[model samples]
Target: MSAAIRNYALVTGAYWGFTLTDGALRMLVLLHFHALGYSAFEIALLFILYEVAGIVTNLVGGWLAQARGLRFTLFAGLALQIASLTALSLTNPDWLPALSVAYVMGLQAASGVAKDLTKMSSKSAIKVLVPANADGALFRWVALLTGSKNALKGVGFFMGGALLSWLGFSGALLAMAAGLALTLIAVAISLGSAMAGPAGGIKPKFRDVFSRDRKINVLSAARLFLFGSRDIWFVVGLPVFLASELGWSHIEVGSYMALWVIGYGFIQAIAPKMLRAKTREPDGRTAQIWIAVLIAVSAAIAAAITHDIAPELAVLGGLLVFGIVFAINSSLHSYLILAYAEGDKVAMNVGFYYMSNAIGRLTGTVLSGVAYLYGGLVGCLVTSIAFLTLAWVISAALPSRSGASTQS
Candidate 1:
């Protein structure tokens, strides 16, 4: 392989590991806290802490990525993840566990921003080599990487759950710690050999590039908001609801989640074709239209989930519906962000895009908590339906492929 290829592959592998470890933690989260006797409100509080920390990190992380380059930022983030996970594993006491976990949550949030910076920066560096016709290819790559990573993390969760059943929380924590340590080691080595040099700083001059182009900026902002809402519901609200309401075990839940990701990965593979089939002009509006349709459908499906449904059937049905929604919407969202963004300010554009999603996440968690408290499943369903409606309307407002103007 060429040196560039080798380097890129190593970085990709590092990200894959990073994702796997993160997924493992996510899969175990509700169960872990529940084991520690945390209530739904407490869970929301922890999630809020996590998002609050992310808000702070997003700003600093963007600046760090601008100054230190994507690779350095990613590495630093990985380091923080390592320490944070280790700390989290050690602190599981009833009284102090939540507070300790919150601190770790903050670190995890910081790592999230750093990781986003790294992924986008790496993609930018390699964009020149990729085919121009590949509008959603980068998003496809991310989905593939993340999906596979989560699949592996599912394995980790399965093992952890079994171990927790047999050997208790300590054993589960040990296994998680081991996996994260290995991932950290792998990323450290990859960064050493693949991305040791100084990274290029962000270009502030291009920050206003979008502002100068009002049409694209407006479209981009709208798209970002729509996507932000989509992510918050999918990532924060859905998982918690299933776990709490359906009494699903982590292993069972992970299996369903794995299926969701499988469906998503399959859609990502065909995202290019989906876009092409939707439009002859190739302006990528095809992707957006499909995304809108899927988001609306997913919201509808999520709203219909209730305790009267069989656990197995509910999981499968919900997974299938939400899976389709997530796959199409996520792919299109990535394509839109990249399309609207200037090459010079790719990092910031990507960061801002994520920050928007983070904002939505913050809102979703709070709302979901309130919804669960009052109306139970109905509240969760309503929130999702509202967001999806907003997304669909915004997408309908966007200009067609042929008539679309330059997005900054």
Candidate 2:
């Protein structure tokens, strides 16, 4: 038991380090390119390859992890990120816009692969580390890992903006890369020689990436739209809107977004308590309820903005509610996917699940720029509402309880 606890802590810490760099990278690229007078849609284009790479990474990352062990995958992910950051540090700001975009896109794709590999490995480790007989322990541990991860990522966003403000683009990338390199060293030393695999030790096949479980499939589908709803507005639309339409400086924009993600993480950390998971675990009905509520909240925000009723307040204040609701929904979905994963093949299941997540982000990233360019924040919100509605419908089909057995 003590060994399990130690390993869990180590894996969680590694996740935190990786997520911090990942979040900062996003903010750095988005703000740096936007500052160069790139259009909104163009800014979105900068991240398109990032999501595309995620789709590919998740497809095979699980098989690699199951075969090689979690520590190997985790190490590989951190190393890749460091490499990507170093390469990006050499970007010459004086180059042609098209050339700069191409260079950044290719690097961003590498970072994307790094991000998912780290995520899949860390998440799968939880199943291996936690004893199966520990009822509801899975949800709590998952929440803590994910919640703390997002909070750190929020801090990273602020760090990115601050670094860019103080150090310039090239210098900021170099600084972050240096810090992450240290993190990788620390994790490598602390993790030592244990290349942990799942408790059941089942080897994963490439074909296992396509889920056979109905519950996993339904949850993955719902997850696709649920995340899409957020990124459609979040990735490019809202940040660009605040910067351009509202005339916010980079610092102000970064700070607000940072606070939002931080608070959202807090909500996620407490979601199990809020939902009273101690009394009864969340199931399909729980998902259905939260998602339906999210749909309503999204609609109200859109309507308020459309009516021009304190437009700024409507968007700002209403989004607070959105963040709160969305956090719970996401935390719930995270738990559900793990719950659905068979113990012998946790890596495979999580990999399949995040593949859907990456796809949704890709879709949303593409739309964020286009929507903001044409219809503004209101347009983004309306599209988000549609995505939420689709998620609700898909979530309704999820089994009230996961088909996976507690003992596997």
Candidate 3:
């Protein structure tokens, strides 16, 4: 195959594999912890550990990608991922629960490193493959791949759930480890034949690492608010509304998540056309503004659906609407990054995007937990409205689409 095709295929395949491993681990471990009698707070804490790992490695990965070149970073990330998974698979009986969480944390950190590195590297490679003015096209391609990654992750979750039911946690973990090993092999082969940069000899100072690219920093700020509201909608708010108020089973809820993911992927599959059309329009900023609004409206609808309407139908309906908003948000994020970020700092931009999201989730989850305790579903609705309004205001501070100023 041609060079461009080879690089895209390799990178896409590698992402698919990594996402599958991540999905399996997340689904299996949550159930395992629940079965081991961990409380909701403990479960959240474990996930928090994983997020912490991601936050640290995300920055490191960005710096490494900038200095070490794409191939080296990618290889190192894959190796670390494999080692972490193997260690998780081999944890002793006494360390079952404790080691399990630790193992997952390592995996998440390694995966974060790999993902951020690969993305930055791929962006560089893709830029060379496509013409300079075709950034819009590049955005569509990357968005489609991202949507595919989510779809594969959902499938992995579904499969993992089924496997966990049959093989138990240890069995599922072992199987996941084996799969991850194979994926690492695939990435290695792709790297061998792919056109990649020599590790840049640039040794960045601490100051440079900490310095925020003005454009990415602003985009990260918008993303933070967006995700903060999303956490309320997803983790605390959605689960409570579905289970306690609507009377859905956990399995049913899981199914709905998978369905939401499928719908998310479907919309993303067509995101290229959407991006193309929006690129031509004058209301890019207006459409971007509506993202937070739609999310807020969806939250309101969820509250309404649970109050007087059919609970189950309301959730399904809310999910469908949320899916559309999510797609738009995802595309807008990529567009903003490509439009404004410097070419060399894609990893930093992506890392900050996720780091902002992590902070948003941490804050939102805490507040939503409080809401769950004090006001039940209504509290969640209130929190959604409040935070989403703030998000709207924050988005207005973002640089408008007139190709205007991109302040940090």
lDDT tens readout by residue for model 1, 1-408 = 756546556666766656655555554565677776777566545555556655545545544555555666666666665655565666646558657567646655654554455454554433322334544444455445444543555565555456667756656655655765676677666556443332343345434322344434444555545545544455545666668766777556667666565556666556556556234433445545665666556555554565454644654576576666565566556555555555555555555556656666666666665665676555666666666666556655555553321223
lDDT of 2 by residue, 118-198 (tens): 999998888777767777777788888888888889998888878989998888888888888888888788777666553
- Total clashes for model 3: 0
Q: Lowest-scoring 10 consecutive residues by lDDT in candidate 3?
A: 399-408
Evaluate model 1: give its lDDT.
0.55
- Count clashing residue pairs per candidate: 0, 0, 0
How well is each residue in 151-236 modelled by candidate 3, as lDDT tens digits?
A: 88788788778878987777777777777778778777756745345323455553455536654676677667676776675777
Off by over 4 Å in 3: 92-130, 193-201, 211-213, 278-287, 302-307, 402-408
Candidate 1's C-alpha runs over 4 A off are 92-143, 146-156, 159-220, 223-255, 273-284, 295-319, 372-379, 396-408
Q: What TM-score against the true fold does each predicted structure earn?
A: 0.75, 0.92, 0.86
Model 2 spans with C-alpha error above 4 angstroms: 34-42, 165-167, 193-201, 240-247, 403-408
Model 1 TM-score on a 0 to 1 scale: 0.75
Q: Which is the leading candidate under TM-score?
A: 2
Using lDDT as the yardstick, the better of models 1 and 2 is: 2
